[model samples]
Target: MACAQAYAADTFVIKDIRVDGLQRTEPGTVFTYLPFRVGDQYTPELGAAAIRALFATGLFKNVSIRTTGNVITVVIEERPVIANVDFVGTKEFSKKDLVTSLKQVGLGDAQPYNQALIERAEQELKQQYLAKGYYAAQVTTTVTPLERNRVDVTFNVQEGGIAKIRALRIVGNHAFSESTLLDQFSLSTPGWLTWYTKADQYSRAKLNADLESLRSYYQDRGYLDFRIDSTQVALSPDKSSISITINVHEGAKYVVSGYELEGNYLGLDNEFRALVKLKPGDTYSAKALNDSVKAMVEKFGVYGYAFARVQPAPQIDRKTHEVSFSIQADPGRRIYVRHIDIGGNTRTSDKVIRREFRQFEDAWYDADRIKLSRDRVDRLGFFQNVQMGTQEVPGTSDEVDLDMQVKEKPTGLLGLGVGFSSANSVSFNASVSQDNIFGSGNNVSLSLDTSHYYRTIALSSTNPYFTQDGISRTLNVYYRTIRPYTSQGNNYKIVTPGVNVQFGVPFTEIDRVFFGAGFEEYSLNLAPGAPASYISYVNEFGETAHGFPLSVGWQRDSRNSALVPTDGRYQRANMDYSPFGSLRYVRATYQYQQFFPLSRFTDVAFNGEVGWAHGLNGRPLPVFKYLYAGGIGTVRGFQQSSLGPHDAQGNALGGAKMLVGDFEYQFPFPGTGVDKSIRMSTFLDSGYVWGENEPLHLADMRAAVGIGVAWISPIGPLKFSIAHPIRTRPGDQTQTFQFTVGTAF
Candidate 1:
């Protein structure tokens, strides 16, 4: 009875309620948290609950509820709002990044201030530094009170030096040498190239990747039971260096006994079995097994089995040291594509992308067609990345939707450049090109080039899809003036202006045919020291000449990548005929290129080219149209345009027949394993040019061996080589080094 009286004394019926200390916070916000309102009965428990709820809002630092004569009074002290946030002494991370990180943790400006959040921010900053190998980094926070019930926050950071790797060791490596295994790791003890490659830096992510490489190396060599036992990373007492140790166990090697196929194979068991790369009595290889599985899965996907699963179950015979695999496949129900959604093309038109799609909507999902579509879009060279994903349609079991997400890259280029070459000495060039003009998938270009030997201005445009059947049309107009780089004692010049129109028709997926017609006018200027042959030609024909040139060509390309091909064949045959001109002749050229991949990072490439020009209607071939060899693109050991027949005055006279062959073994640059952007090659080059009536002979060929580097740099593509001529005559001009910059080869 005494407890009941005490509780009743603290209870009351509220007639009105009032909240105090409402700076920055509305009174209605306080009322929303109150448990009881006016005209409602309030007990001591209810009043205590209201006070707790208001404090939990984080807006108030203190809260008190009291009642006098049936009226409730709430007293609160609001927490100070953050007026500004700033950083000091931070260098490793940008200010925007820190602010964004803090905002994610509810510590930005205009938010209520709290000491706990400041501690969290400091801890996060330290963790970020630690990830970057800054073990001794420090962070401090400061809060300064300001007017209008606000405060300013500042974070000061001190980023210490990066911890480098001092030592690296491997344990229990028997089949392979320790040095050989260490060579596969990106991280290493300090070495000569560490300053540039940063290979001596200690990083958890790099360590993990190295561990995976180590595992793959063993597994690919028949070590079926290889395992990494443990890894230890230790830092020096001063936190300036780190040491890493990796322990591995290699079990017994095994050989493949046989393989079996299990599960439904869509009535193509023999086809699926033939896709296996493994053979009986061969060494066991995880890579081969994965390749066989991937091939089988893709085969199923070709038949519209979009959701297919293939698993390998290996059986081990420990006594015989043999292993067998049971490949199990479960191809789900055949799916039909309902829709294809394309996104991330902010500037390109829908038709521009849609025309490249080989897989149509409302069709059975074909993986091969989808892949072809993606490749075609990529070949347009207007996007940085193109990704495709499948989404299951809602309320449908055997239907799916495809989403193609592309990241657009700049396709318009306006460039001005200056360069130096052994042949031309100095050159200046300017160009304006738009590959995807106005997102209409049309190409337009205007260019001007000036050099010691040549000067030219050109304008060109192309429409890849001029018709619905994917035919392409191109138009080009140009005016060019050319002078011999070294003409003995003669000064001769030729000015030519031309316009051409061409059409490209696709005959097959990898083949195209082109036909074009050009109208050109040529004017010649000759000074003293001109050759007798040139004077005879001028006497026979007038100074100015006009011609109508017709061209036909065929090209077939099967390279996996257009920019850097590893395994493929490319062939081209072209012919040009001038039927109505003072110079009546026919010229033809054939070229073939073959690339064979030796491994994932190495390749052997071969190129052969042959050209011939003959006079028609008993007319002589034009001297300006003759072919010349020996340069960066021909034989690297000889001077540019210096490998042909010489005139009586010791000047270069280009030939009517040419032959060139090149063989190269290419690999990634040192310390840049598997990076295709920078490559090194050892090459053998042979080529020669013949006179108008000279017979082709292998004895006249010029051969050279060289080492070269190709780099796809940010500024442009660059190639340089140093060569030694194998056989040279007294008149042959030899150049030990040759290079080209700002060229796309």
Candidate 2:
């Protein structure tokens, strides 16, 4: 007992921590788990804490704390390292998916395995199944010890029957009828066409998202105090049926009252007051009121009030249900820029953005100039993120700093893909593009395509800052050959090569005016099945040694974001005339697209395109320049390049006029994290080609209904679709499929 007391009294102080049995981990890592560093007191609590912390790392199976009187030591027997990972009976996700999901919970390649990680991974997997309505799913994790202190893991999952939404019942909604609320929910009992929509499945994620949508719908329209009171989910005894209840609180609506303004406005009161778009007797809208305040502050910015504030005071008249707002402007400490910091660009050069800035460091701040700067940067199309922030500088009341950051993405792309169908038989295309060419303010692209009857090569370039004066310019050079179908195999090939340069001057932020001119030459070769109408035109007016083509266009693209547009309008109208070229022709095309946001995940887009080509100077327009449709970009249900005038053999004989329309609904993925990168879409595509005197008719046009999946992969966008022809003639096929390996634009 005396020796034991003496040994206990001589407690060891840690000289240093030496960790062993670590392969994938570092020694310093173990030190972070140790409570006592070098030259510290070690107690029983500290020893226990060290063991627990080591175990929490999920890197060890057994952690032992021992002390030999004056020398305390910690020893750990790490779990066998992961030698391999395998999945069994999992078709919902791939092996890489399982690996990624397991790694999140601590089990990964080259990492030590612990029972705790296995339990966590099992729980996660079960939760995922529950989200998909698989409440009775079973997941088992087995660890097999291997050689070299490693272990292999296998996850066995037996996903049972998926719980379905047996019924949907609404309770506690007194103001509105139960039927009204039921229409808002996407999840419902199976209907006659449930096999297609899958509304019968009850998903927790879907329910939660729907509830949020409901809340937003009420709040945005003046239910400022809307709240989701509670939600309850119940499963039947058999675990095959699920029931959900959502309780909501809809508060009373409030009206705006008259208000008065205070705070001093330095010689800018009239200008700022004019910005208040709201007046007395208007409905109370928090969104509109907030926008008015921002507008007032922005007006003050013109006078160098970078740090301006607008406070709105409202006086409510309960009896009259009217409200008036009084606004006050505070121009606090007009500051000059001291420094500017640019960040977040990993692949693009900083100079590329700095060149677009209209506001300079050390100059007085201007809101309009700053907004223009942002627009210029966003137009680059090479970044995924862009933000600007201002910070006040200490010790100086009239100085501030600005910081701008951008996230960069790949700027160059080259893609090649082929498609084969019964109609087209075989088609191939290649494209080389650079969105941001050499860090310069230009976009350049070259494209080539060839089939049995047609061949085309085109080069295009666009400069955003054309003349060092902020104007935009675009240049194009195209060489194309077309072989007309003939009964005697004597169809002729028309070769047309031309170049165009267009200069654009912005009329406003949303509109631009473009003017350009070019030269072209057209020559024909005799081939089989040549059409009489086309042959006469080529022989009369299409045989030109040199001709001049002049054009003028107007464009307005005010879409919020070009990659995935919502809530904006894109309009373009152009007319071209080649009077002196190999052929005398005049052509005109007009396109319009409008996007309406139905919800965060839903959008309604309407697009229409019309083209008209005519012969001039007593000659017919060459058929080689005729319009073609019924492809991925045109009508979706029919084979690509399959729409136009057809011969006895069902071969296309080009046309002079065309029109098309598109209506699409893009669906969002629940867990993909690729908000803008992956989307599922359904579209209705209709269009048809016409002869000069051919009458237009709804019956002659073909329409298709289809669904497709688009992914912005590392290489490029991968789009695949399967469509069915809704209106087809007896001889026409009813179904088709297509895929494109690049950006849809």
Strongest candidate by TM-score: 1
Clash pairs (backbone) in predicted model 1: none
TM-scores for every predicted model: 0.85, 0.71
Native-to-model Cα distance after best TM-score fit, residue 739 in candidate 1, in Å: 8.8
**lDDT to native, each model:** 0.85, 0.74
Could you give candidate 2's per-residue lDDT for residues 1-745 as a string of tens digits?
0011111334457665565456556777788888888798766667767777887776777677656644655666666788887888776667787788888877787877667677888898888787777888899988888777888988899888878888677666655676777766777787775555667788767787778767655644445566878888889887888887778787655565555556877765676666666655555666677888888788777667987878877665555645677777778877788887888876567877887787888898888888778877887788767788888899988888888888877777776766655553456788889978776757899999875556789999998777766688899999987654322333666787989898898887778888999877777765555656656765665454566888989999988777777678999999888887565688889999999888867677888998889878776666656777776688877765567677665556656788999898876644333376877778888888887667767677888888888888776878888887887664443337777787423
Worst 10 residues of 2 by lDDT: 1-10
Candidate 1 TM-score, true structure as reference: 0.85
CA shift of 505, model 2, Å: 4.6
**Highest lDDT model number:** 1
- Clashes in candidate 1: how many? 0
